[model samples]
Target: MKIARIEVDGARRVGVVDGDRVQPLAAHVTVEEVLAATPAERTALVDRAADGAPRPLSDMRLLAPVAPPTLRDHITFEEHLEGSLKLLGRTAPPPEWYEQPVFYFSNTNAVIGPDEPVAVPPGCERLDFELELAAVIGRPGRDLTPEQAGDHIAGYTLFNDWSARDLMAPVIPVGLGPVKGKDFANTLGPWIVTADELAPFRRDDRLALEMHAEVNGVPLPGGGDTSASMAWSFEEIVAYASRGAELRTGDVLASGTCGTGCLLEYWAQAGDAAPPPLRPGDVVTLVVEGIGSVSNRVVAGAEPVPVPKARVGHARRPRPWTST
Candidate 1:
């Protein structure tokens, strides 16, 4: 089932998408609430909601499919890796970058739903968009084997890891994870599709699905093609991340930038010449097959006005600097 959280008449409710229409589930039984419930209870809840009177989808606004996620891991794919590396003047990731799955945590509070406006931060001259597939965790486990990892997946959704490339470049040289550059905004939704629905699309090299992104009405570079270009699998990423650590329900694992997933694929080296950064009134739409498209508008943050300094008389400027 494709599940979603929707706001209707100022109240939030859970629902399932049936074709273009949505059938409200329960006002209180959220996706997180269902995942935390026992299997029997979950099934019963689903049945009860199906039989109960439901509200029409057209009357509501779709919120993020899942409640706030506990944690998020950005998984790297080869096409994205190769494309980014070549742009940086390297042929491929260093031996260690690919020896095992690598990931980075995204800010939980920064997540927003489809159609929400993203605030472009101050000093960010180059903002880019990344189209990706996100995996949601259903069961909790630690040190899981690859086979065991597959069982823990609950669903999938479309994600857009909005980026400020200018702010990102300075911190990457220190080998630390992306901090302020990535914490600004991360977008997901349309809905969360159950694992059973998308299982056939997950494959060894990469899941075969068409993914694309558009800025306003025009398509961006690398905006067309199938997700089959990935060199790694989501299962491998889950297993690797769980090795010696715990994977819990409600955790989100993102398939990092897909090849041609962002403007970085073509303009990373152009430095100051990157396409005009996302600005107010720009609409970004990302579409992933099976799952639906997530569209958001970019709004300029309020510009801070400069305050003028007052001039002081010349008689009081003799303070000396002391070393600590």
Candidate 2:
């Protein structure tokens, strides 16, 4: 069953998407609430929700399929990694790069759903977008074997990890990791397609899927086959991630950017061209097969204002740093 969050009449509620209409779930359950429900109970609740008065999908705002997630783990796709390495002047990833999966923690608070507006931060002159597939963890498990990992997934959704290249450049030199460059904003969903529905799509080496992104109305990137490019399987990633840590419900694991998934691969070359990043009034739309599309608008940053100087009588002295 496809699940989504919708806002109708100014109130947010969970719902199941059917055709162009939505069937509201029993009240607006929090992410934790839905995760806590048993699979059988969850299925029954969705069925009952669908029995209610239906609303046109176009009339309501589609929020992220999953509620506020606890964490988002980004897994590297071979195509993206190879392309990125070449862009950085490396011949290929060091042998050890593929020995195990690598990931980074992204801010769950930065997530927004379909058709939402994302703020283009100041000083970030090179904004980019990545088209990816994200897996939602269903059952809780840690140190799970690869054979057991498949049962832990609940569903899948399309993810767009908006990036700021300019902000990322500085941090790379410090070796601190992708902190500021990545945390800006991440987009997910049109719906969370349950694993059972997507079972046929998942494969050992690659998921046979097509992905594409458009800037405004023009197609920017994507036309390649995902099945031919992926380096690892979702099961491997889940198993690796849960080695010692517990994998809980509502945790999102993302397939890192796809090859030619963003302009960073097609338009710009390292140290040569840094095109003007996404600005206010621009829209980015990402489409993945099976899963629906997610579109977001880009808005300008609010101008910074200056603060007035403190009054003379209220001025404070600086504290001494040296210990006597």
Candidate 3:
């Protein structure tokens, strides 16, 4: 089943998406609440559809599926690893990366939904987009097994980890972040397709879905379906993420970038001339099969706060983003 949060006349309500119409819930339940519900409870929601008639899907604005309690993204694809390393001028991926799945926490407050505008920060000349798949946790669990992990997911949505590549270039070598580079905005949802809805597309381990990325309607560099790609399984990512802590309801975990899902990888593929940095008015879209797509329009906001240039002098390296 597909669920979404739509705003009609400035009032946001959760609903069930059936065909081209959205059956509004008698009581507005946030997507988070839906994720927290039991299968029986979720079924009850579908049953309640008869309580109110669905409105045309075209009549309302779609928002992020959930007001995420927390957001974490895992770097799981080898192609992305190799390409991103080169983008940062590294010869190879770090040894630790091959040993385990790595992820970073992102700014949940900076999220944008479908068709929303992303604000470009000042001083940032290079804005990029990361096409990814995000999994929304359905239940709370700790130290789960990979086998058990699959059951914990509620649904999937398209995720674009909007980035400031120019700002990230300098900080990556220090062995610490993708932070400010990733802090600006995270685009999620056109709608959330329940995990069961995608069960039909599952191949051995990865879903047999075609993933794609586009900028202003022009297809970007490398993007292929998931079956042949996605090195680490979503189960493994979730299991590792839940280790030593609880995976709470509504927490979002993302499959970093699929093969060449971001500009960093594309840069490694096509070099500096592949695609120009994102500018104001540029639109970026991320698409995943069975699931849906989320597109964000770039808009200029306040000049991004300036960062002091790093100058090396007298055998000491000074960092602009952090002092180490």
Q: Mind giving the per-residue lDDT tens digits that candidate 3 earns over 1-324?
A: 888888866778887888889877655566677887777789886676433667899887898878788899998878777887776677888788887778999999988789999988666888888888988999888999999998899988888888898878777778678657878899889888888889998888766678888889887754454734777788888999999989998899998888867776766777774678888999888878897677889998786565698676657566798656
Q: Write the per-residue lDDT of candidate 2 for residues 1-324, one digit (tens) a residue.
A: 677877867877887777888787666465445544556877776665554698888888888877544655555677677767776678788788778878888889889899888887656777788888888887888998878887888778888899988778767877777777888788988988877777677665446677778788777634644733667677778898898898888788887887768767764344454334577888888888777788999987654355596567875567697455
Candidate 1 lDDT over 1-324, as tens digits, reads: 777888866877777787767777756677876655555666677888763556666677998887555556565777777767775679877888767777888888888898999988667777788888888888887888878777787778888899987878877887886666788888889888877777688666446888888888677664576767655577777888788888787788887887767887767546444566677788999988888788999888755356586677767545567334
Tell me the lDDT of candidate 1.
0.76
Pairwise TM-score winner, candidates 1 and 3: 3
Record all residue pairs in model 1 with backbone atoms less than 3 Å apart, i.e. clashing.
none
Order of the predicted models by TM-score, top scorer first: 3, 2, 1
Which numbered prediction scores highest in lDDT against the true structure? 3
In the order shown, the candidates' Cα RMSDs to the true structure are: 5.7, 5.3, 4.9
For candidate 2, report its TM-score.
0.86
Global CA lDDT of candidate 3, please?
0.82
Residue 195's lDDT within candidate 1 is 73
